[model samples]
Target: MSTGPVTIAVVAGEASSDLIGADLIRDLQRLNPGCQFVAVGGRHIKATGAELIQDNEVFSVMGLAEVLKDLPRLLKTKKQVVRTILSSKPDLFIGVDSPDLNFSIAKAMKKHGVPVIHYVSPSVWAWRPGRVHKMARFIDGLLTLFPFEVECYSGTGIDARFVGHPLAKQIPLQVDKQRSRAQLGLSDKKILALLPGSRNREIKELTPVFAETVRKLNTSDEWQVVSSNVSEAKQKQVAKLAAEQQLELNFVDDTSALLQAADFALLGSGTVALEALLSKTPMVVAYRISPITWWLVKTFRMMQLPYYSLPNVLAGDFLVPEVMQNDLTTDNLLTACREVINDPQAEQRMMQFHHIHQSLLTAQPDQAARAVLNLAESLC
Candidate 1:
């Protein structure tokens, strides 16, 4: 007996999710050989040969204020997505990250008798534990990055699997610092990478602080700051900022290379933190958002982790200092950056980061792709 192609609908709402979704699609296709995919994604996902219904930009709001501004567009897109999925009736609906958008869409699609798999658990373990109940109602399975997240869905009887982070598997545990530096054309002198963020708004809010911090740090050491490019617009914005600040900066399309090249990194909190951790690069995490959005996040108590950086969070300690909101000032950021740069024990701490990196890698084949393939097989 021969099985028909398994149709999977995937929605990935951010750059990191786009990369992960693309890799997942490749693995799923490898397993079934004839699987079909359609949904909203980015260039990376498009490269995987998936039919794109919409681009991820439709649902890429970063903060509460931003979400509010884009609410009407988001709602319209959600309706369109629901209508499309209902018309097509895919066997599996894979929601890759973006809990706010994907979870709502999954909830609506569940009524059509499609299995909903939520990849990347929203931090219910950290805050708003009540979300688990809603997730259980809509999601058939939850694929988590961290092992600790599996317990969050236990009470709801939700099928949760700890598929170690894709980055942990993608990046090497011990990067050759000299080789990376040589690849990026940098001297053996102290190198500091500035990852303001991948989003335009993130660069606007954090780049100034990061630039100023670089200026402060430059007083002590000749540091080379590198910015990651997500778009031409962001690259131009960062270039302008770097020029205005009179800072020596390099622009790279791949942030992973920048992480590997740097001795330490000053980054905005998000996916890059995990990437840096996997590269075993010591970093200082910093972030800033609109005042109203900050107030809302604080009032709602959504952020529960003591540290924002993924390495520190995974290590269950303050492995890296997090300077957020008011603390994200140039002076404070410089202090944190300097501490990581000057500390003699910094390399030792990065070695510990390497150990954590190894622990998160798949023991067998690529766990991320295998996990998605397993889900696809079950649907078939």
Candidate 2:
């Protein structure tokens, strides 16, 4: 009996990871045309011809309340996945982000003699540094976005690589603000980009404050609000919120363009912050996960990071103001945005953002694909 073409199993549970996973799949396909992918992914990875085992996005949940609400379904899905992966082992199993979900899948697949590679380094450097110990048990290799992340794997013998984020290459080093605004059909009005987040629960927690901030900022409609909505519901939610406050937002799906067109941004703290940095759009960040989630996190002291936003973590300093939780108020957000917009250092900060972008550029998809392939070859 002959083994057919190399078969890899991948699981990417979030939109960001889906994009990274798709890029990786394309590059892997280029190198090994006959390679087959059995995956738990979303639209992006599916676009690359990966066979779907499950829609990974369903497993993505934020806040303790939300997770608990969906816990029964999550457990059921987890068991179903365990059975799926173990039914027939593939050459390699790659888990992309959602380490909470991915690592569990990896552990199961690892026991079945599958070489396990995790695409994103869970913020062990930021929180629960102790996870470095557990990493050795399941993760064979870790593909990281930032070069500094390699330090997180210091004591662990786990293989890690800095593949560089694809966005650094995808987004232009310098965006033409005039062109972007022209394309978006905006006039002399200063643009304030709003990126609440993709998840409904996150929008629920943050959009109210975001609406208040926009209302305060748009006095006399001096600034045109441009918000990016990840889903139709979020777009409608933003619309409802804007209508309630009598605010006008040029809601668009093309977030990158909006980021490029904006004078500055007010966004929820997450991957959008990273995207803002790549777009060279100076922003003030905020987040509110739920009261119970906040209490539990504080009670347990779960997070170990000095900063919350990706730009701050990457720069090792407060690159932009992050007003999280209770501090995320209209007055505070307005102050931060005005400070950034009016400060003489605005250009200087954009320059710093440019430097950070340069630092993130590398042989992306190819290097990442090769790393995964090599790990699988060595293990299998």
Candidate 3:
């Protein structure tokens, strides 16, 4: 074993990535106490003792239009990160989740002899399969959150490994809903947890539709309608909308706890859907992006998939309903949610989720860290 300090350069752009990056760093430290992490990360990564080179927000935006608006700042941040990383010449570079932003950065760093390990394979199996060759040029190791992604990289000459997802192991197979509800002081009549997503763009697009759907629920007052926003600003926005619509809703701060409390959830199609599934909460996923982004995705055939939500995709069949764009209406959403809420099939769905949960409990961080370190060692 090498006695010298192992320096790692990491960039994690969002909350989910931050959590994974943090866990990876903690496990890497366990493997080698002399490991030093230099990163651009959010709270979770910082909690694991990384010296943050920049805040994760510097690269946190989604959709074509949103990214276009922040392109200049993003470009500048990439240059700054490249310069800083080159000066130190770390043993490993780990780009977590933000492949749309971090892929180019990793490619640039590879020119300077830094071995890059990208955590969370970009949805190549679903779309953009051509990028595997491009990824192979820079990424020495590709760590995946899903088991299926490993086969997607086969014959592409990329060293891919499935590290599983931390959420699977973190959440218990059975969530104590009654205790969670009591903790939130929620009353018993059909609790609905609304997760509109964590981004400002998501809030702006989905909140009105969700607010309208909340209004249309039968015996609305009997059912406790609650939403958890990612920011205080979004919570305030939901509050204003609730007042305008004359609806009663509890806006909570802790999303995980809210997922535990939910009998079912109306969520935006993203990581939250997976979280809700991990909590064994049946959900109706909905999303509406800017028309430009929607048009570009359709026009270019960017990421055509049979199912968009993680649960449905993982199951290889429809376990829940996911409505997108114009179909994500108040009436459609309300109807879909009601059907899911009162379904006899929900028990089977929950059982399937439990099996998926167990399958995904493959100890993510240790596996991911070991993969990256093995690549680093081979490079040495």
Per-candidate clashes, comma-separated: 0, 0, 0
Q: Tens digit of lDDT per residue, candidate 1, span 233-254? A: 7788887876777776777777
How good is model 3 by TM-score?
0.93
Each model's lDDT: 0.81, 0.83, 0.82
TM-score for all predictions?
0.94, 0.93, 0.93
lDDT for 338 in candidate 1 is 75
Model 3 agreement with the true structure over 1-380: per-residue lDDT tens digits:
25478788898888678877888888888888988889988777878878888887667687888899888988988899888877777877889988887898898888888878898989887777888888888888888888888998898777888887877776788999999888987787677887777677777777778877877884537678888865687688767766676666787777888898898898888788999999999889998888898899889898758788899888988888989998988889989988998898878889999988887867443677777777777765
Candidate 3 lDDT for residue 351 = 95
Q: What is the lDDT of residue 259 in candidate 3?
A: 92
**Model 1 TM-score on a 0 to 1 scale:** 0.94
Clashing residue pairs in candidate 3, if any?
A: none
Q: Tens digit of lDDT per residue, candidate 2, span 27-102?
A: 8898878788888888888889888888866876887877999999998998897788666567788888888888
